[model samples]
Target: MATTNSLLLGFLLLHIAIHHSVPVEGHPNYSDALAKSILFFLGQRSGKLPPDQTMTWRSDSGLSDGSTANVDLTGGYYDAGDNVKFSFPMAFTTTMLAWSILEFGGKNRMSGQLSEARAALKWASDYLLKAATQTHGKLYVGVGDPNSDHACWERPEDMDTPRPVFSVSSTNPGSDVAGETAAALAASALVLQSQNRTYALKLLLAAKDVMDFAMQYRGKYSDSVWTACPYYCSYSGYMDELLWGAAWLHKATKNATYLNFINSLGANDITDIFSWDNKFAGARVLLARKTLVDKENSFDPFRFQAEDFLCRILPNSPSKTTQYTPGGLIFKLSSANLQYVTSITFLLNTYAKYMASSGHTFSCQNVLIKSSTIRAFAKKQVDYILGQNPLGISYMIGFGTFYPKMVHHRGSSLPSISSHPAHIGCNDGFQYFFSGNPNPNLLIGAVVGGPDQNDAFSDSRTDYNHLEPATYINAPLVGSLAYLAGRYGSG
Candidate 1:
């Protein structure tokens, strides 16, 4: 009888989530969180800083990024605290940011962050437009050398590092990076469609061209550009990117060919995870949208895969994967753990919305899994990120009373160009890097690579694994924050 009562109570909560937003007690101001998350991009921006750029500490740098190759790869984003502009993860970041607006754009609008989101997205897309169209059948994978850049810790403005232009062509194949970029362009195109149709069409065309390159010349990007190895290597291979790219292309154009491509995906490629390195799970979740919302029976396999992932993530399910900290944080990896937490939570919130709005109930192990429970779990994780954890620290910089000040970012650590106009040599900035003091300038809004399995964080600038903030870590998080901000409006 006690077990029966507990089940009934769970179901009641789930039912409420379907009809109303679950009142997440102690959730930090989500709208504020969203605003701050968007602000992080301004700090991460590469190339010429806009006049209105709020991250004043960040100055124009990497202006001559592709000059060696005589191609202008000036924009996009820096991959992490280090200055390399790796296309694979950079493209993934753009896709997630655009996806956030696509999912909860209305919420951003209400919270007055829609334009900021679009602008931040445009910064990357504009760079992508330049990067992808540099040559026909050629896609530049990265700019700047990670080893050399890591050797010297200087501001992007003051550094005189060797900027080597890398690419994957018909001869040097890299389907993964190409396909990921295609997906990014397609996702961004969708976001810009109603806002700027002409630009959207231009992006859609670029996506098609890149997707063609990815499909025709089949190979891993990291394989072609050996430099990217040991860093952003293609761990799960190129098949996932090809499928993930096709899904986004289908989304942008409703092209049946792309759908057929996704439908024809191999069973081996199916998985229940999403990350910069792997998109198999993200692909499943995206394709499931069609099966659930559009009622496309052909995409049923992906829908089932999506449900499997949900069951594992939802703790009450019998077959659930035990991947949580004692504090209820969805801990996956020890290093940069929040990446998994944010990305997985985004899917949970996304699927929850899809199910609730479509009036579909989720079942696991012959038990009902309410959309509310999924989102409630998602919210709990987000709250942990925003200062409800054992550490009582907000992992997202600049959102709460206390955040990590020793963010492992070179630009943020050194004095701004405006302050210290004197040139700091490429290698002379090690003093700034090793300093025990907090970063001179805050990397406001950067979602740092978070805590250990025990929910403990080492807030040291030297602790790159747990302290370094990356583009990929913050991207999917933008979508999650926006959705929650909208759900818990004006509160």
Candidate 2:
């Protein structure tokens, strides 16, 4: 006990020393720290607490949600600040997580995030396998009752609410969800292939089956289920998922059919913004990478669409598309806008790396999308999220000294001390309560819903869009930050 206490004291002192070293009046060098922060964020949002994991802040979560629908829904990551697990976005996040590791894991492996990244991805992949196999060909798309889950403000570990599960069948299709899940499984197969080839093949076969089901059915899940609307809805339509799933499937397995399918689609309706709901941007990037890196001249048709889309996102395009804040964040929707910007940041960094490697300059309408330009824009976006913006506050939790304290996350807001013991659970009734003080446990590394157009922000628990953090928001940031840190060396 004495030795342990001494070690703890030493660690605390070291932390304080490093904390004081951060520049008081400049953009703090938090790239390395922020990379670790992203891992912590994922760890906290994990559904099932592993034995080796040490998340003292979060009690064993998603235990009650286990065995819902008589299926073991025990090993996926939580969707957002809420306890629910929407498998569509959850799988999307997992796909990005695996992609980050595969594309940029070398430096991260040295940085100690690779293990956490693998564990996080495995957690979701395991759940996806169960979700796929339990119901034969059809996959479980959505888990948890968002209506019931959101009604209570308690932690996932303490919840006694209804834990219902939802799925997609051939008669009732969910192309977006199933396609995204296939993308996740396919991407994860690459990550796991070398480590465990047997399991990797299982993921591949499952991905093939899931993709086949999704393509064969060909309809958005949100249209079929009223509960999935507006929250985890497919805003950009379902065709994007078909393209996205094919792109991933092609990447996982060098299949000529997947390439032909994407080629037949022609110029994709360019949605300038991308998110969990939208996979067009992701699909375009993945296809472009394949075209550039392939030793053979296969998938060469994708080069045009990829270059076209890339040029649109970059500044100075003839279109002059993509709105930006005064602080320089690529703004899309007013609600929780950082999610959109961070997603773009990750994509830009990825394309930039690919462009740099290809040594070929891309232009659209005579506006050059050079490697330097892409890197500069991506770095600026990253800087804004850190502390370089007008507000001079980092959007990420537990990074800079100043960040959102009253985040609109139930898990972060619940009182550590029970003022009224009887009112702990939503047994009698419930009223949405926001704690007056800062969150008791720092949801470290969480990138909250960020500032407004004019760089205004309120650290109020009532502001849901501006304060709540989600896994999708942080997932890209992890990959983005890792790329930046590996390229430039963390500050």
Candidate 3:
């Protein structure tokens, strides 16, 4: 396997040598390119784009969904490959975005990404404020029914289907969604604190109130809307999110109450993997950050657990549980597993940097764990996604010369037509899921569902699970890419 990997790496380098413009190695301007990729998703927003955003492909979409339901839902990002906005995942994406900005936004301020990130942050943060600050603090979880939105292939701006809204209240509780939103707002407050102190305080106060609501009334958002289970289900329950929200609040405000809540949990209470549903690993990472950077030993209670998490995910750790693709991606699931790989990559990369900054060192499997080693491991995953594997194709659209043209996305695949046209050519090529034709519009910087466990990838439009791109995936990619560009000179 080592010999085969070396041969493959040689071939990939040679391929890039011949095709200089390919995004494999020595690609200059990756920082700017990655920043643009993040902006691409923000521009794909269904509602109004901020003044700084020069959006063209999509106009106002699902604006009336708020008016019809008498609730403000004019902002927030569209979920993967569809127009429906699932608040649970959307809020999680916002929290990650804000965290990324808070972590590395200062390093690449000259790239103008800081401004773009701030725009994206405020867009989602403002929408979250609206969602949480409703009558009697009821937070809406799902906007636009998934079934109704998936029934037809129409632009979000032109859809005529019922855009139903779902909410979580004291009677209908949703601790997972509520807690994640609280985390998002809390992190957003930190992102905005330097520039807009007033807005940041407003977000923090709201986050505290919302966290209280989530803890006081505990349940998953999917309980209220049964249809949301298959899409944004809380498989790991709400305790992780509650702790996660409290952790972020403690970090942002340094309040002892929030710190007390986090210290109350057991050290081994965390799960290894971090995702939209699972915040245990992420909360641990944040806690570890506080311990290392702030020199605050007050987090002594979680010190052992944080060290355990770091060791478990390391390449040579005895407790390493994450499986890898044959081509070397940290695989977790069977389908579109690259999303999980990329998300975990950011965490590992950030944690490694934290360790490096603090001059921390440890021995695993007779090999010393250093920041450079951890970062090198994280960089391998980035290269794999950008055409270093057996398939040798970039999963992120418009990054490399070769990529998937049929990315199972309606907005990019369907023709842009004005006016509401019912059943407009819906049956034209629905049968042949792998449309021979390229997508009508180019969704640049949009990374589609990635390859399978065996490094097998089919660039087909029919395979939604393997071709769809979600905001959560892109959120982590932004941070990882930024960190890479800063650490290793782009191009």
For residues 1-491, what per-residue lDDT tens digits would candidate 1 score against the true structure? Answer: 99999999988876654333333344468888888888999988888887999888888988998999999999889988988899999999999888888887884343688999899899899988888897876888899888888888888887587999999999999988998999999999999888899999999999999999998899998878977888888998999899889989998888899877766656355454678888877878888888778888887888788888888777788888747788888877777888888888888888888888778887898979888878888888888888877766788888776789999999899999889999988777888878898888988889898888888887899999899999888888888888877777545
Where model 3 places Cα greater than 4 Å from the true spot, the runs are 1-29, 50-53, 365-367, 418-434
| Winner of 1 and 2 under lDDT | 1
lDDT of 3 by residue, 239-342 (tens): 88988899998888889998887766552564557788888878877888777777778765454565566566666777776677778787777655766776
Q: What do the candidate models score in CA lDDT, each in turn?
A: 0.85, 0.76, 0.76
Q: Give me the displacement of residue 15 in model 3, in angstroms.
A: 4.8
Q: For candidate 2, write residues 1-491 as lDDT tens digits.
A: 99999999988866653454434343445466545555655444546565665545565666655476787777677776777778888888888888877877775432667777777778889888888888775678766778887777776556666777788888889988988999999999999887899999999999999989987897889887666876788887788888998889998998988778777766368667778988887888787776676534565556666666667677777865777788778887888999888888888888888878878677778677788888889888887887667766778887766777877776666643233333368532224354466777667778888999888998888788898888888877778777766655646
Instruction: Supply candidate 1's per-residue lDDT for 200.
Output: 90
Steric clash pairs (candidate 1): none
Prediction-by-prediction clash tally? 0, 0, 2
Task: Give the lowest summed-lDDT range of ten residues in model 3.
Answer: 418-427
Who wins the lDDT comparison? 1
Taking all chains together, each candidate's TM-score versus the true structure is 0.93, 0.90, 0.91
- Per-residue error for 244 in candidate 2, Å, reads 0.6
Predicted structure 2, TM vs. truth: 0.90
For model 2, which pairs clash? none
